[model samples]
Each structure stands twice: as C-alpha cells, then as structure tokens.
Target: MIACNFSFHYTSFKCEKNFGVFLAVITIDLTSISVTSAVISMAGKVMKKESLSIEGKQGEQVSLLIQNQIKKLLSLFENEPIQIKAVGVSVPGICYSKTGLVWAPNIPGWDNYPLLQDISYLLRGKNIRIKIDNNRTCCILGEHWQGAAKETKNAVYLAVGSGIGAGILIDGKILHGFNDAVGAIGWFAVDRTYKDAYSEKGCLESLASGKGIITRVKESLNIIDDYSGYFKDIKIQNLVIGDVFDAYKQKDPIAQKIIRESVELWGITAANIISAFNPEILIFGGGVFGPGIFFIDEIKSEAKKWAQPLSIDKVKFSPSQLGNNAGLFGAGHLALGRF
Candidate 1:
C-alpha cells in the first residue's frame, strides 16, 4: 500500500510493503553531462542504490542518453513496487527556480534551456514533482541533509575544484539570491591588484583554484632562471593538478610558493564565508580538496586572521564526509523538500 502527503516541502508517497516502508528518491547530477559526461543515481531512504553514466560528445546524443537512463530508472522502480516520492536534479550552472531553465557554461546549447519541461515531458502521466538547483547549493544541502552539517541550521560548503564556489545554508534554508547565483564565490574580490585574467573568473578564483595554481606555477617558471630540484623536468603547458601535487610533495620551491599562496587565498575565502553566514560548520569538498585535504589545518589557521572574531571561533572546519556524493544526496533532499 502507498500513502502520500502533499505540502510545500515535498510531495512524499509512502510505500508500505510486507516488511517495511521504503521511499524511493531519484537524483540526477548534470555537472558532467556535456559533450563528454553525465551521472545519475537512485536512492531509497538511506543511501544511493544505483547509478549510471554517459560519456560522449554533446548534441542530440547527450539528450538521448539522459532520457534513456531516466526511463530505465523509472521502469526499474516501477517493477520493484517502489514509490518514487520526488525527483531532484543538480545542475552545474545557474538554475532559474521559477522557470526551471538552466545556463551551464561548460555544457554547450544549455543556455537558458527548459530542462524541467523536457524532464516533465518524459513523465507526462506521472505524479512525481521535480526540483532543481545548482550543484554548489546541492553540496551544502547534502551535508545538512545527511552528512557533516546534519541538525545544524547554518552551514557552508566551500567547494574548491577547478574553480571555487560555495553552498550556503542559513537559518535552515538554502540561500538563493535574486539571480539564484549567490554561491558563485569564484568572482569574489579577495585581491587588491587585479589583472585581465582575474576578470575572467574573479580574483579569488583566478588565484586560488586548481587551474589557477597550475597557471601561477607555469607563469612563475617562465619568469625564473631555473626550475631547480624536482621541478627541473616539468612541462608547463601540460601541467595538471596531479603533477603540481607531485612537485609539491618533492619540496619543489616553485610548487611550494604557489601552493602557499593558494592556501592563504582559501583561508581568506573561508573567512569571508564565515563572516557573512556565521555557519556552525564550514565543510570543504570538490576535486581540488580531494588531494588538497592536507591543507585543512592551515586553512583554518589562516581563516582566523580575517574572519569575524565572534563567529570564527564558533564554527567548525572539516572535510566532507560524503565527498563527491554530497551533491547527489543533496539532490535527493531537494526532491524530498526536507531541510
């Protein structure tokens, strides 16, 4: 048997089977759903159960891949007698709440695309309601929903990836500014002097992001007389995050200098987030932080310099427990409309 309750929070359908009740939730992460990738998963009451991926060039092929995977999940749930309570989707770019349109910079042809309508079209006869939001917001919400920030009303997730972004939760509500772009912290001005490149992705992001670290290293090497020590055999143009980390581990002077700057930038960014939101916990995640987790203590120590005296000491700084799955679970929480 199934019982459903409709409210502003979520339209939850409770499925009572012979042994227990199971609520099925579907979460789709479209961050990599471009000319090269996509990932979707299904979750029950506790954790993610299954997931699928798509890797190919962008075009009609990508659309078909998404639709086919969704259909398959729907069918799988239907056969298991599982009740899909809600569907939550996390987009890589800006998500217009009112119109369900998306503008993803990395995924071509998605500028203001009517993504919700397209998904709704696929479930024309179903009662499931879909909710969509940016991946940054999803990351924080995921933490609040089931990870580190659980039970906390105020928190922030500092996502340091190729670029920097943040997910803020204030007073138990996800903060979505007028343009639904509140967490685009990459553009935050943390530096006094600006350059042309800084204008492209913001001063903070251009200086502290993973790619930024690589760029700084490359530029530093070009101006110096030598790449002494472990950096001697490095290639600038092809430098990647792993290579930079390797160099850092080997105590390469250039890598050390660049990474030290990045750490300070991260700490400054954290201080800003702390001063603004006064969250209970400041969670760190994203690709850069995966290997860069070693710097958490230093980041915390640095944040103490600029953060609000009253709030800085009150908050906790920690790495994400959910890791890459933070956004996925956050999407599930969105579908359930639960804080």
Candidate 2:
C-alpha cells in the first residue's frame, strides 16, 4: 500500500503470504511536523520564521519525526497481513546502497548515516524489508515507468531546484559511480580559470542553482532587500529562482541579466553532459523547471552554440511529465524490481 497527501493506491495479497513490501519515493517535509521539546526550546529567540537553524540534537529529533511518519504510513496497512516484503526509499542526496549510508547536505546529520539499517531496525520483527536510492535515480526511474522516458533506454533527467543535480540512465540501468555520486553536478565548475574573491573555484551551482540566481541578483543590484516585484512578494526570507523568472517576464533589467547568465550556464552544463553521456533524451524536472520551461527555447538555442554539433543534434529535450510524483513512482519501481 502507498499513501500520500495527493492519493493512495493499494494492492491486495493472499493470506498465505507472510511478507510484503512498502515503497515510498517522497520528499521529507520537515516543517509539517513538530520538533522535540529540547529542539524547540533551543530554537527560541534565534529561530526566525523563514530561516531556522537547529543544533546537532535536532538530528535525533528529525529521526524521531521520520520514524513517526513511517509508522503512520505503516498503520494504514493494519487491515492487511502484518508481513512486509521490502521498503525502498528515494531521498534527495548521495545514497551509498552497499552500506546503506545517505549523505544529504540539506538534511543535517544524514551525512554517511546508516539510514537503511536504522530504518530496518525500527521495523524489526515486522517481517518487512527496506531499501533506498537517491532522488535523481528514482526520478528517472519514475519517468521511465510511466512518464515521458517510458520507452527510452538511455536518458538523463535534470532536477533544478534549490540546487541542481542530474540522474543518468544508460542502457536501461541506473549508473552509480564508485562513491555513488555520479549525478552530483552541483560541484561541476564552469570556469576553469575563474575563482571567487574568497578563492572558490568554478562550481556550476554558483551560476545555475536557485541560490545562484539570488546571489547573482545581489551582486548585480547590491541590494539586500528580498525579491519582490510584479509577480511575487518578498514574503520568503530569500528570493527564489521563480522570482527571477517573474522578473524576466516583466522585463526587469536585473532579472533579464540573471536569466541570461543562468541559462547560458545551464546550456554549457547540458552540452557537457550530452558530450560525456550521449543520452538519447534529456528531461528537465523540479520547481525551477516551472519557470525554466518558458526559457527552454532560449536554453536550447544557447546550447547549440557550445555543445558538440553532432551530440547536440542527437539529443531531445523536454519537461518532466511526472512532476513531483516521479520519485514516488520510481520508489515503487525499485521495490517491484527487488522481487
């Protein structure tokens, strides 16, 4: 059985079966749950509405929160037999499947954490199994399961959000490098010679990520105000990439500059991926892609300038049809493949 705020799809099994599997490809929404008393108390005074940083103890608190969420999900299947086959989870980070360690920068303390073993221990004696994968690989798997990449054996899915990453599928298999960081493109440097005033080298994320857009805007305008204009308000603490797109639509000079630079960076990255991987299709996903679609033609147009002429001509680009559900679907596929 699979459940989410969006929908629930359940499968029935025979009573003779003593085991079953539960797969979840969902993003962890931390804000929706309440933190522990200690965390809440520590967060006092320093915790701003939009930006709240917690200390190390928060990791255990978050682990408890996740355990509860999983319990709640498991409770839904109470009516059925208690046996469970396996649970496959897709997260937003570099997952080491062999050791079941997950390194997610966004989630503190998750770095090199034994997520699978821990979760399995939590479900011990339940006659169930658990597995995990990164969101990028899951996204592409979801697309292939029922979305635009259904028939393609070799494809790439780019997820552009707070950070940018890619999922590469070649010859119908997910490619995970030795360290399981094959698709981590955020660190891909665009400028070989360019370095930050602070001495940081060329990170693709510095130029193409959502944070990158805001940073660029700040550099250009030298204004500390949050992003606010025609399309959106400055309610959020920092400006998101969407605001940049809104500004572009309204013809804001700063927004235009940011878009032009960001798009070019994306094009260059795409060209490099195309040349290296030679994927048949390139699918774009994530929140940033919402505004990115409006600039697809421009992205492609610029990509043609830098991409290998033949390589660029062979690849097809399109938006992700699965949207947010791609990860969930992919998790299900991963679970299914386990059998």
Candidate 3:
C-alpha cells in the first residue's frame, strides 16, 4: 500500500493503510451550478474525476440536473474497488446549516431553496452522508487543505466573482457564524454615505466586484461626453470584463479611473477583513480575481491607509494558487473529513 500523509481540516490522515479506504467525493460548486466528482485516495491523489455543467437552468431544474449528475457519477464509478462515501456542496449564497436551505441571488428561484432536502431525497437509502457550506467557506478550506494556506492556522479567502464574499479561518477552523453568514462581506458598509443601491450588495462589492466593474464602465460611458478611444467603439450590452482590462492596458482614462477606484475599495475591504479576523494570510480567488490579481500589490498598499496598524503588517496578501478548483478540493475535504 502507498503511504499517504495529509491534513483534513484539523485531523491528520497519515498511514500506509489509509489508502485502502479511498473515498469518492462529489463537490457541487454552484456558482452557475457545475458538478465535479473526484475519487480521492488516502495518498492525496485524485484517482478519478468528472465534471458537468448546468448553465442557463434555474430552481428545480438545477436541482434535477444535480441529481442526474450524481447518479451518472456514481454509476461511472460503480465498478471501482472503492465505494463512494460522502457528498459535499459549495453553494454561492448563504446555506443555513441547521435547516439545509440555500439562498443564492445569482441562481434565480433559489430564495430559501430546500437544496439539502432535494439532494437527500434523490439519494435515499444510498448510505452516503451529505454536507453543505457556502462557497466562500469552501474556498478557504480548499486553500488550507491543498493550496496557498497549507501551513497557516489563520487565513482569509476573499472571493470576487460576479459577487463578493469571504471565507475566514481562525486557528485552523472555518468560522461559520449563526446561519453560516459570517463571510457575507458583500453587504459590508464600506462607504460612509449610503445609497439605496448599496443595500443590495453593500458599498464595497458594488464598487469592486466583476459585476461592479462592468456597472462602473457602463456608468462612465453614459455620463462621459468624450466618447473617444476604447470607449468609442464598445456597446454597453456587449461589454465584458476583458474589454475594460484591455482598455486599461492601453491607458484608457475610463478604465484607469475605474480600476484605480476598485483597487482602493479592494484594499479597504481587505483591511476590514484583516482587522476583524486578524488572519495571517488573505488568499484572493474567484473569477474577478483572475484579472484583479494585477492589483494585489496596490490593494495591500491601499489597505495601509485605513487598516488597523498593528494587524495590517502581520498579514500577507496573495492570489489563490488553486484558482477555480479551490472550492472543489475544499468540498472533497469536507466530505472526507467532516462527513
């Protein structure tokens, strides 16, 4: 048997015989409802893997897609020597731990969705346990388990995709407050003056997330009289993040101003999280961070403007090494360890 050594949350799995119990872990990362199922060996190898995409679906249709995905994955691995044991899902919004309900704004018709109940019903009598968590928490767990935060007990994962959220790790434990809503930093009051719009996703996220970035560009295009350079050719409806960043490289004034403002907001938000959690490292991930990675240094520099002086210097800020896979790995670890 191959010797396997790794840490699962707080527990360490270290032994040669541990390989005999290789478990199939299904990670349902529902940013847009995608499924990734991997059979992980005790030796830390991903023995088998499969993925499915269910874009453009919503509500009960999405639920049915997930059930089919699980059934397909299980059937595919039916002949394998190891048995599937547990399933862990990373949801986009708040996942009520006790109620097993979900609320993701990005996925329509999911207000107070009974996700856990639906999944459980589909897998009835399978003898497999299921666990659920917010995607932010899963991102940090994945980083802690196999990515950037490997040796750190305290860490924060700031995910800026279509929206913003955070996953905090304090003393090696993921912080899940009442209702698992600890990391809903998108609603954080980052601005002094409040607009009715701020109430939707908070001041910081409205100005800094991918959706925010597009909104800013649209707002700029609408108000600016000088329709020259990159802004001259782009249509509001057809605009993408790549268009704005591409313009930023060529020194477009609109892109520069928007990016600069977003950098400061990211910095301020980073400071807020650091002051609140006092984490040793802040790992940046999510789709927005794919392009925003360029601003990490500037964000840290800006954080010094408002962050608690004592804690700011002690923290290190970096981009996530695991990229899109952070939540998947985290969900797998949650299945293997917590379930």
Predicted model with the maximum TM-score? 3
Clash pairs, candidate 2, are 20-84, 20-85, 21-85, 86-129, 87-129, 189-202
Per-residue lDDT tens digits of candidate 1, residues 163-265? 7889988998888888788899999998888789877778887888887888888888878885576666765676778788888898888888888888998
Model 3 C-alpha lDDT per residue in residues 103-207, reported as the tens digit of each score: 888887898899888888877888776777888988998898889998999999999987899998898777887666889898877678888888777777788
Clashes in model 3: which pairs?
none
Clashes of 1: 2
Q: List residue ranges in candidate 3 displaced over 4 A.
A: 1-21, 33-37, 42-44, 48-53
lDDT of 2: 0.64
Using lDDT as the measure, the top candidate is: 3
What are the runs in model 1 whose C-alpha is more than 4 Å off?
1-21, 33-56, 59-61, 222-225, 228-238
Worst 10 residues of 3 by lDDT: 1-10
Whole-model Cα lDDT of every candidate shown, in order? 0.75, 0.64, 0.79
Select the stronger candidate by lDDT from 1 and 3.
3
Runs in model 2 with CA error above 4 Å? 1-58, 80-84, 196-202, 223-238
Least accurate 10 contiguous residues by lDDT in model 1: 1-10
Clashes of each: 2, 6, 0
* Steric clash count of candidate 2: 6
What TM value does model 2 have? 0.77
